[model samples]
Target: METFLGVDYATLWFLVIGGLFTGYAILDGFDLGAGAWHLFLNTEKDRRIALNAIGPVWDGNEVWLVIAGGALFAGFPVVYATVFSAMYVPFMLFLTSLIFRAISIEFRSKEPMRWWRQSWDVAYSLSSVLLALLLGIVLGNVLQGMPIGENFEYVGNWLEFLNPYAFMVGVCTLGLFMMHGAIYLIMKTEGRLFLHLSALVQKAIIFFIVSFVITSVYTLIYFPHLSDRFKESPALFAVPLAAFLSIANIPRLITKKKYGLSFVFSSITVSMLLIMVAIELYPAIIMSTFDAAYTITVHNGSASEKTLGIMLLMAAIGAPLVAFYTGFVYKTFRGKVQMDENSY
Candidate 1:
């Protein structure tokens, strides 16, 4: 119950964990997005350029994910234990996709055979799309509720994670990442390639808008509880409003050939949407579908206050170092990708 600036340590840890994952989602989301475009880009040179575009920084971007996962495990061991144990299949699929994604990037250019490159191309694109989908499904499932019982055990069937709502959320996540990736690709190409990617950016814009709108409508109609908080407290509505504006700005920026600015908004859109999710499910890490009494609140799911405090102190010292290095890598490799013999 220790307070930091009037917020309890638990709540602060929740914010820290959320912020770290948000950073992961934004950084890795583009990598996945760029991979999603691999097959659609036409020609091996285009794909290689796309690969090298992210090459210098893609693996480094994953460090945020590792840190985020570790932070969650440290700050909320109960939530971490239950989620990883119960949602075994989805997490495994996620891990598999992550590995395949890395493999596709590394192995795609190792040979001169068309079949070999095409094989890795398919692996890269499919894995990226699947990874995005799995992330969405897990989040959707979490947003809906868990089937935890007394003693904080997962009592329901693991296959229940495949419900309709989760699939819809998964699709939305894919579309959003695709759009985000298209915008990044624009920044990494020129001339004909840029025009081709411009067309893709347009298509991705429409795709995400349609997916986002459809998912929003479905949630509003069938998932009332998720929106109840914003409805009751009108101020919380700004999050969604900002999300709308961010999504809207991407197209305008693209039209103006301002892809750098567009990518910034793409990052913001992901952040705002996740922040809204955090707002909708505050205090409660996982709501129990079977009984409200069985729900896992931050207090129930977290570690000892001392453990959280120590981990938080570590994050405070460590986050900036990670961010600084990440920014440095990206800055060093910024601008259009110039592929050479050493390129991916």
Candidate 2:
């Protein structure tokens, strides 16, 4: 068992994979959130402005998702295999939504016809909403435990993935992304559209807060195991505390007309919530409903130490470059979106 900074390679790889997905969630989250708001912009020009707000960065943001997937496959093949196998329908639907989203964004502005634009707008918004829900449902199922029987194999039916708890998480995820998207929109638009989004963002904030409260109550009541870690170590409660404070600060920032700071807090809220999930499920990647002994954990599910070490070295070299590139793109595109001929 190789160790880096007193942590095993498996644990390190787990953290790496988690970090990659967290990046994806934060970066692409607003894109999905913005798309989720597509149908609500009220006019063609409003829609176009919203669309172009994310134009330069959406595809680049998706790069994080791609990297995260690759990291998952490399670092935890068993969990990857089992999860993909178990949630085949959801993942396929997710991929379909992703395709529709991309095509909707590209195709919406390709024509001037009212019918054509309207059709694509619906597709874009629906796909974005579905994508957010599916991501949450998948995560909810993972948190609740899967029906892994043996050999780290998932023996559950696809329909089982849509249980009540998962749906609540899905709704919660959608609300969070919508709020995040609204804040981003407020930051990027001005005049009538900015005012519209400013009002809409308040509703989004309320939506997310309500959904979060319901989901938290459900998890604490039905999935008590999630809170076990916090109970065992009282200080670990700070993650959720931070999550609460961050969520609280977003509305505060928005009210103060500090949308740029609001966006920062929104990103922090996403990161903190994911961190709490990581804390709740440390060591175990996927819990087994059939039997606790059959759970897939970092130690049992990870690639060989040598493989993880090599990949860790690769991530170390590549991560900084990716971060730099992402920063460069955001920096280049920073400030209010102005529409021109090149705008989407």
Candidate 3:
């Protein structure tokens, strides 16, 4: 018999994972979109507007990532340890890039020299690209399964990590985020910059559409086990179909010049894709290539019932507060970014 505590634990895990990704899409989406359009911003004023568009909210956006990580650590320590231990190098690189990007955003303004500012801007853009790619690769690796021994430890060498399927997944992830970022910038900025950013988004959307199609086909053909899962779980197909439909809606949204709608559609595309991936990997938190029995699932990988219960209680109180604070921040700062000498 299931207790209320067990149900609560399950519900809280779903909420935290879903909420973090949603928050990430809504918050980091604009920043990434702004960075994607950075090269097109020819004037300092344009660049500053791009920068300020994300200024007040970027710090807050990072909180979701922290929460996600903390939830993973506390609720699923085994998965956390295995993932981090296996992918230590990539994780370090990801963290380093994020740190530099965050610091550079603040420090760039303080530098009076053109070269210094330009250097930081480049760092910001590159870091964003790397971070997105790393996330993609990580997702790809999870989906494709890793070499896990009987002891539930990773057995594959670092070099063998970049398989063809994983690479394709990485490409898909990178392209999707780039497109997601572009849509975000189109919604947030105005004037010639907005027009230019819109064009960039259109191009990116096309690229991602092609990549998505190719990746979908590849996954179907090469990953027969996953394809079998899709066949077995007919209901799960809705997620990817929704993602595809969202992709299709982008052109119409763009044609109408409905930037906000375009952004929404782009976000839907991402959210649906994530949902599809999660569905595909259901019950298996971490799949094992070396040993089938070694696969980690929510039942086996999750924390103790008592700990999960307490975490659920804390999340119940905290999640609403997070939502309210995020909404307030966005509402308070709602407007086109204006460039000023003091802008940072």
Candidate 4:
């Protein structure tokens, strides 16, 4: 195994993959959250503004997912193959929702008829919510542990993926996204829409808090192992503490009409929570419910040292370019969305 800065190449790639997915969650999460709020807006104009708020950057945000997938394939092909094969149904549904989401955005504006627009609006919102839930559900199953038999093959029934813990996690994820999206919408609108979102953000904050509390309690009671790392290493507690503070601060910022900061904290909340998950499953990417031996860790699942090293070099060169491009796009489209001819 190649060593870089006291960490092995596989560990480095694990961090890289985690960072990529975290970026995706922070970037794409807001838009999906925004879309989840679609049907809640009263009028067509409000819906249009909501849609256009994410118009410029939604597709670009998805690029992180594509990159994350590629990185998974490159860095840990075994884990990728095993998990994807195991969760094929969920992933397929996720991909289908992504397609419908894109199509809804593009097709919604093509026809001026009310029925056409409404149909796409429903599709857009439903797809957005479904996507967020599915992501959480998948993560939940990963954390709760999958039933992998010999050769890393899934041994459980397909429907087993929808167990209580996974469903709860999915709900929590939806709540978080909704809160995050409301804050983004608040930052990007003015007048009536802003006021509406302002009121709605309060509800979103409560939704997230309730869901978060329930999920945390459930995890501690049912899955004590997830917290063993933090208990063993007191310093790692900082991540969860930071996550809590970040979440706690959201309501305060929202009350002060400091939406920009609220959005920042929302992003922080997402990052901190994911970081906590990474901390919980440091070496293990996926746990095996059936047997400990089948659990996939960075060491057992990574690519060759040379392959990882070369890929790390390429990632070093490419990641910055993608970050820069993402930043440029956001900077270019900053501020309140204006309904022009090109707007979604």
Clashes of 1: 0
List model 3 lDDT by residue over 1-344, tens digit each: 22474554654575567667767755676576567557667877777777888888888988888888888898888888988888887899989988987987899899788898888888888887777777777888888888877667888887665677777777777777777777766666788988878778778878788878888888888776775667897886787778778889988888899877887888788788877777777678789988899998777778887888788778889989988999999899877777777797
Instruction: Assess every candidate by TM-score.
Output: 0.98, 0.99, 0.94, 0.99
- Enumerate residue pairs that collide in model 1: none
The list of candidate 2 runs beyond 4 A from truth reads none
lDDT of 4 by residue, 1-344 (tens): 56999999999999999999999999999999999999999899899999888988999999999999999999999899988988889999999999999999999999999999999999999999999999999999999999988888889987888899999999999999999999999989999999999999999999999999999999999999999999999999999999999999999998888999999999999999999999999799999999999998888888999999999999999999999999999999999988888876
Q: Per-residue CA lDDT of candidate 2, range 134-183, in tens?
A: 99999999999999997988887769998999999999999999999999
Candidates ranked, most accurate by lDDT first: 4, 2, 1, 3
C-alpha root-mean-square deviation, candidate 4: 0.7
Query: Candidate 1 lDDT (Cα, whole model)?
Result: 0.90
Stretches off by above 4 angstroms in model 4 are none
Clash pairs, candidate 3, are 33-181
Model 3: lowest-lDDT 10 consecutive positions: 1-10
Query: How high a TM-score does candidate 1 get?
Result: 0.98
